[model samples]
Target chain A: MVLDFYFDFASGYSYFAARRIEWLAAAHGAKVRWHPVLLPALTQVTGVLPSPVVPVKWAYVTRDMQRTAQEEAIPFNPSPAFPQMLIAPGRAMLWVRANHGEEVAVSFARTCFQAYYADAVDIADKAVLLGIAEGLGIDGSAFLAGMEDPAIKSQFKEGNERALAQGVFGVPFVIAEGEPFWGYDRFGNLERWLAAARKVA
Target chain B: MVLDFYFDFASGYSYFAARRIEWLAAAHGAKVRWHPVLLPALTQVTGVLPSPVVPVKWAYVTRDMQRTAQEEAIPFNPSPAFPQMLIAPGRAMLWVRANHGEEVAVSFARTCFQAYYADAVDIADKAVLLGIAEGLGIDGSAFLAGMEDPAIKSQFKEGNERALAQGVFGVPFVIAEGEPFWGYDRFGNLERWLAAARKVA
Candidate 1:
């Protein structure tokens, strides 16, 4: 079966989930599909301030991300330009997916997350998005225009809508078969659930 | 090291943590100190609605708790009368602690959590709180009075303030030495952190 990983470039937990999902999917013999969703839209629908805007949750997540990262030995430094949408990077990845295919699209997604989280770069900036695209050998000036392409923008919107329709209300949401699991913390629960099916098979 | 468990009787995840922590602590050769905190008060200070009031979270939490509970095989049937505080029960436990001892207080807290989550009882009810007290061999008539005792009320308030001072903004918040961990999901992390210290010692 396939595991659908719905993530946002702005989410620190999603960064970790991306770093971890490859191995976990490999272990279970499942293909991973990365779908980027806009976190603000989901949070707006939930009628609560997004975690970063809420003082308590911001304080908790900043520390939680660092603590969990340190424990897992993952390279982490939350972006100085955090809480900003990576819409430009998101659209760029969508264009890459359409032309280059899933492997490169997934690579673009991972690099965007690494840029924002690991390298503390502004993934939302047009130059930074172009830099990431060129790093993946996608030509720069054309890729810059493609990030604003109407077709790719619609595709990004569609991905977010589809993720919401699949019952994803937060970042780092994963679906194995059709069962949805939210949070990096629930990764173990997700693995165990998958294992039960494996044992039965 | 002492693991301070900050919990509320209203929380289903706290119920699971209460069940799981004992063995985790025993395995690590650490002591657990249970601290009851008023969830609403903590949430109020956070300037956000509690999970039960947020539709997305309320939906996720209900499903997440059930999914987690089923995987772990814990006895759970979230209180039909959930989203209600167990204030009387909280005070009663404080009274039990003052009168009986920590052992009895811990037992009282566990029973209240079980009564709320497993049995679907309204733990906020005075008679229910009294029944729970008497079930544990405490005198029902005197215990009912003790639940509202001025000293017990103030002690409960003091306990909540102390939890806030320690940066507890959510249920199942635990502190191992000076490091704080939140949520039932973080139990493994807490255990791993404790294990590191154990090895060094």
Candidate 2:
């Protein structure tokens, strides 16, 4: 079974899942499909406003995200700006998808998560994006140039609209065999359901 | 330092947390305060209806609860009747608090978690509750009588109201010192915050 891992580079909880999902996917022998989408658009489509729309949930998100990171042994510190602007990283991801295959995009996405959650980097900044590209052995200048392309920018926008069409509302969402699962906490459920389905197949 | 564990007997997540909380609390040199409150009231105040209110969240909850239970080495099975009726259990908690100390109420609350999560018993049924009480060497009839008393019932209602006033939105909602931390995952934060407060003291 293929598990579509829907993530946003700016999301902390996605970092937690991104760190562990590969191992979990291997154990379950499931294929991972990386689906990078904008969280705000997914929320708007579900009629669930951004977490900032609900103060208490937003607080819970930060606290719980930190704890999940700690449990998974992932380094995490909330960005000072918090809920940082995602347009740049979002565009970079689309650029990766266009230039590279799914694997490269997934690797870049995981690197962005580490940069955002562990290094406390401002993901929205172009320099930080260049830094990530350099670390990934991709040409930093080429990546920044790709980020400027209108096609990549439009691809990010279209990804958000597609996510809404798939009925996504939150981060770390997975679509395994047409079934939707949301949040890092639900990854286990997605795994179990996939395993059970494998038995039937 | 004390880690206030806000729980509802009916909540699966709280039950999932209960198995390891004692050990984690001891390791962190923190005291556990078993504060029982109705979850529905907490949800209403936080603008969250219930776990069942969001289908995607509810799906994740069932899978995650089961996996976390296994990972924590706790016995648990997903129930069709999650967000269980707690009218009697809530009152029983308040009765223990009124007549007994917080220690007794907390003990009773943990026992209830075992009854539901580990043993897979129907906690809403009085007979099952009485059976659990008997195992604890308490007079089952007296416990039943106490659970039904009007004053006990009112105290549970008051507990629900107080939880809402405290800005609690989820089970395993924890408060360390004066700072509110929600979810079982935040138990460590509760510990660290208390440790810091102890250092200041």
Candidate 3:
């Protein structure tokens, strides 16, 4: 069974899930389809804006991320710069998938989340995307050239549309064989559902 | 330190927390201030409304609850009657608290949650509450009579208002002294907060 892990580079919980998604999927004997989507489009559809706009949500996300990171034994310093622009990195992610395989795209997504969340880097800038791409051993010029392509930009918009069509309203949403499960917390249940689906088939 | 446990009788996660609140509080040398408020009112103030009303939130809650339940090794059969109407039971909870001692009130709150969520008993009716009162050794007449009193009714409203004032928007909200922690998942953090508070004092 393959689980479609729909994630965004700027989401904190996505960072938490990316750290263990591969290990967990391997343990459950499930294949993961790493998906990158624009969080802004998702928010518009679900009436969920960037949490920073809502003070309560912002506070909740901050505390929530802290608790989750502590639970995962990862050092996470919540940045004030979050819910910032991800247009560059997001399009760059689409570029990776177009030029490279799913593996490179997924790895780049993981690196971007870590760079932004753990390393407290501003992921919206071209320099940051280039740094992330170079750090992952991908050719810098190809990645930069791909980022400027309108096709890569269109792919992100299409990905966002696909996510909206699937009724996904949040990041780290996993759709396993058409059953959409939202959030990092849903990973286990998504796996269970996938396993059950596989067994039934 | 005394922990104010804000909960509703109809809440599933509240039931999950109810069974362990007393023991856990006692273990940590913390006293429990059982704050029974109508979940709906709190939801309005906290912006945590019924899942069915918001598709994304609905999905998040379902998956999140399932994950937490499994991790806690608790049985979690999510009832179709989620975001259950608690107007009657909620008023009764306030009525009991006004006339009864803290311990009895707390037990009643816990039992109500347990009966509805854990035991699958119908707690939407007055008979169930009467039975619960009788079990608690309270005068069933006075308990029932108290529900009609204007003062008691007002207190119920005030409880909801107070919960909102405390930044609580959901059930099983624990306020360790003045620091508010929402849901059963925050229990461990509440404990640590109390321990640190005690050290400082």
Candidate 4:
């Protein structure tokens, strides 16, 4: 079985979901396909306002993420400089996926999430992107070149379009067999769903 | 303990939450206080866009409600003519709470949810409000008068303000001990929170 995990570097829920999805997939004998897209760009396309769209929701999300992270012991530290222009990490992550295979891509994505969320690093910086690539044993120059690849750049745009077409209004959106589930909160449903599908399979 | 259940007539998740909240509350030895606020008005105040604000969400919400309703065996039928102007019912419900107590208010709210989401009834209409009141053995004339009460009208506005003050961005929003949980999906968290609080109490 396969679960298509669509995420964005700018989404806190996506950070939580990305951290947890692999284990969840493994438990249900399912493999996750990581699809990174720019949340701001996609939401703009879908007429869904970007996060911090509302002051109340912004306040609520901060509290909610803290509460859930505490409950699950997920070591969440929201970036002091959040809502980072995450297009860099988003494009780089997908570029890694195309070149380095899913495992390495996932590893690179995890570092970006950790840097932005856990360590408050500015992942949008090209220097930071190169640093993360070097830390992951990928040649810094090659990774930087990959980040600038015209095909990878266009792939990011097409990826956003494809995700919007998939009815992905929110981050940490997961799809399996055309069934969409949104949010890290929906992980319970997704797990149960994967378990059920495994049974049928 | 008390659970503040903020709901709007137009929210399908509110219908699902309203149906199940009492049972869940009973299990945790808590009482639910029903607060009816206009979802559209409140979301606007918070800058949280209304349902159908985006084409993708409108489509997703339709399928989501149906899938969830089926999974839970809740009878579900969306209003053919939705986005009903619900000021009449909202006012009537608060008035019922003031005069008739929480139980009557809850019963009225449940009927409104059912009418709009289960039976495709135009619950926003004054005639429909009177009919629901009459069916519940309240004086139809008195109910209509209460819906028009100046005090009730002010209360409705104040209620929306209060809900927003407490950071309500959406319906089926439940708050306990200063912590807010949104959506029918958050019921699991609500139950766990309540149960944990019970132990500490």
Candidate 5:
């Protein structure tokens, strides 16, 4: 079975989930469809305010992400300027997926996650994104062009629309056997569900 | 060390956390102080919208609660009408603590959680709350009178104010060593923190 893993680049929780989902999916003999979604677009459609704008939640998220990162053994030194503009890297993920393949796209997405979340790089900047793409053996010029392509932009919009249609309101939302598990913390329950489904199969 | 567990009666996540925290804290040689806060009052002070009012979040919360309950092995059949009015029970908990003592009050709070979350009882109803109190060997007439007591109402207000002063913006918030862990999902992290603190001691 396939797990539809919906995520947004700007979300720290999504970064945490991205680091682990591949191995987690592999353990259950499941395939993951990494769907990059624009969180703001989904929130706009759902009419829910972003957590960063909510002062208390924003503070809690920063602390939670730091502690969770340590628990997961992943480096997480977020940039002081959080909720970084993710449009460029987000669109680039789709661009790579379209041109290279899903494997390369997943790798690209992880690099993006690390660049922003661990290395504190400004992923929103075109130079930094191109640098990340070049390191991944993706042609810098083609990658830059793909990111700006109107078709790629449209694809990103379609991804957001599809996420909203699928009742996904937050990052790291996973859908397995038509059950939606939202958030990185729900991964344990998702794993249990997957194990139960496998046994039934 | 004391693990201050801040929660609200109306929160499903809080119920999930409530079921596990005491034992978890005891395992680490820690004492638990259960502080029940009115969520609406905290949200108003923090200028954040309630999750139930946020359509996408409310949808996620219901699904998350069900999955979490299964993982925790707790009975969780949410009332058809959710975001139950928690004032009567909230005040009643403080009254029980003031007169009966902390241990009995914790039992009283757990019963309230099961009454609303498991049995789907209307905890807002005065009769229903009094019945729950009486079941716990609490004086039903006194509990009824306590619910209407101005002193209890003022104490409830004080609880909300204290929560706000402590920077509590959400339910199931656990504070230890001046660090806050928000959400029931973060209980794992909280447990880890407690263990580390104990080792140092």
Candidate 6:
């Protein structure tokens, strides 16, 4: 079964999951479909206040993300200016997925996540995004054009609607065999479920 | 180092953590302090919306709780009327801790958690709590009186205030070496922290 991995560019935990999911999926011989959705769009549907907006959880998450990153040995240094406008990167990811293949899209998503969370770059800026795309061998100008394409924007919006419809309320949400797992912490549970399903298969 | 476990009687994850924490602490030669807090009070301080109030998250939690409980081999069948008022059980737990020893209070807390989560009994009702106490060989009438004692009620309020001041926004929150780990999923992190602290010691 294919695993649907939903993430938003602004989420640190999503960045953590992005770094590990591919390997985990490979180990289980599972294919992963990365869907980048606009997190703010989900507020109307999920009624979830952004974690950064909630003071106590925000503090806990900041500490937890640092500790978790260190534990996983992943490079993580989130920009102080967090909860950056993810719309541009979100659309860019979908644009790459539509034009270039899934592998290229995955690479693009990872770069955006790393740029924002690990490198502390301003991902919301068009210049920074173009730089990221150009570094990946994708023509900067064309990538910018694609990001602004109405069709690509429509697809991004559709992706958010689809995520809401699929009961996704948070980033790093994983769905396997129609069962939903929310958060990177549930990755272990997802791994077990995948193994169990593989054995049954 | 001692591990401080902050829990709420109505929290399913707290029940999951409650069942395993003592043993986990003992394995590492760590002492555990069980602090039962009123979750609603922390909400006022943290401005975090209750999980159940967020529809999609609430649905995920229902499934996650069941799956986690099964994985942990803990009997869990949440009461149909969940988010039950935890005040009575909260007060009773403090009473047990005040009169009896810490071990007895831990036992009383476990029973209360099991009564609500595993047995699907209404922990909000004083009669049900008294029955649980009587079954545990505690003086049922005296337990009832303690639950209602003005001093005990004041202590319970103090406990909630203490939890708020400590920056507790969720259940199954663990603190060790001044680091806070929230949720049952963070137990692994807590273990690692304990191990590292021991090495330094």
List clash counts for every candidate, in order: 0, 0, 0, 0, 0, 0
DockQ-based ranking: 6, 4, 1, 5, 3, 2
DockQ of predicted candidate 1: 0.51
Q: Considering every candidate listed, which one attains the maximal DockQ? A: 6
Against the native complex, each candidate's DockQ, computed on alpha carbons, is 0.51, 0.17, 0.24, 0.54, 0.46, 0.61
Q: What are the RMSD figures for all models against the true structure?
A: 2.2, 5.4, 3.7, 2.2, 2.0, 1.7
What TM-score against the true fold does each predicted structure earn?
0.92, 0.71, 0.84, 0.92, 0.93, 0.95
True contacts kept of each: 0.46, 0.14, 0.11, 0.50, 0.39, 0.64
Give the runs in model 1 whose Cα sits over 4 Å from its true position.
none
Candidate 1, residue A100: Cα displacement in angstroms equals 2.0
Superior candidate under DockQ, 1 versus 5: 1
**What local lDDT does model 4 show for residue A176?**
82
Worst lDDT 10-window in candidate 6 chain B: B42-51
Where is the poorest 10-residue window by lDDT in model 2 chain A? A44-53
Docking class of 6: medium
User: In model 6, what is the error at residue A185, expressed in angstroms?
Assistant: 0.6
Worst 10 residues of 6 chain A by lDDT: A40-49
Residue B78's C-alpha lDDT in candidate 3? 41
| Candidate 2 global lDDT | 0.73
Q: Ten consecutive residues with minimal summed lDDT in candidate 4 chain B?
A: B45-54
Cα deviation at B18, candidate 2, in Å, is 2.3
Tell me the TM-score that candidate 1 gets on chain A alone. 0.95
* Local distance difference test, candidate 3: 0.75
Q: B1-201, model 1: which lDDT tens digit per residue?
A: 799999888888899999988889999999999888888888766665678777767888888899988988999876678977667777888899988899998989888888888888888888888887888889888887787789899988999998888888888899888888899999888889889989999
True contacts kept of 2: 0.14
Runs of candidate 2 with Cα error greater than 4 angstroms are A1-3, A15-33, A43-49, A63-81, A84-88, A100-169, A173-201, B27-29, B78-80, B130-150, B164-167, B178-181, B186-201
Write candidate 2's Cα lDDT for A1-201 as tens digits.
Answer: 677778887677777888888877788788787777778777653345566667877776776676566656778875675685477877887788778777787788888877777777778878887887788778877898999998887887888877766767789888877777777766666667767777898
Tens digits of per-residue lDDT for model 4, B58-82: 7877777887887789998767768
Clash pairs, candidate 6, are: none
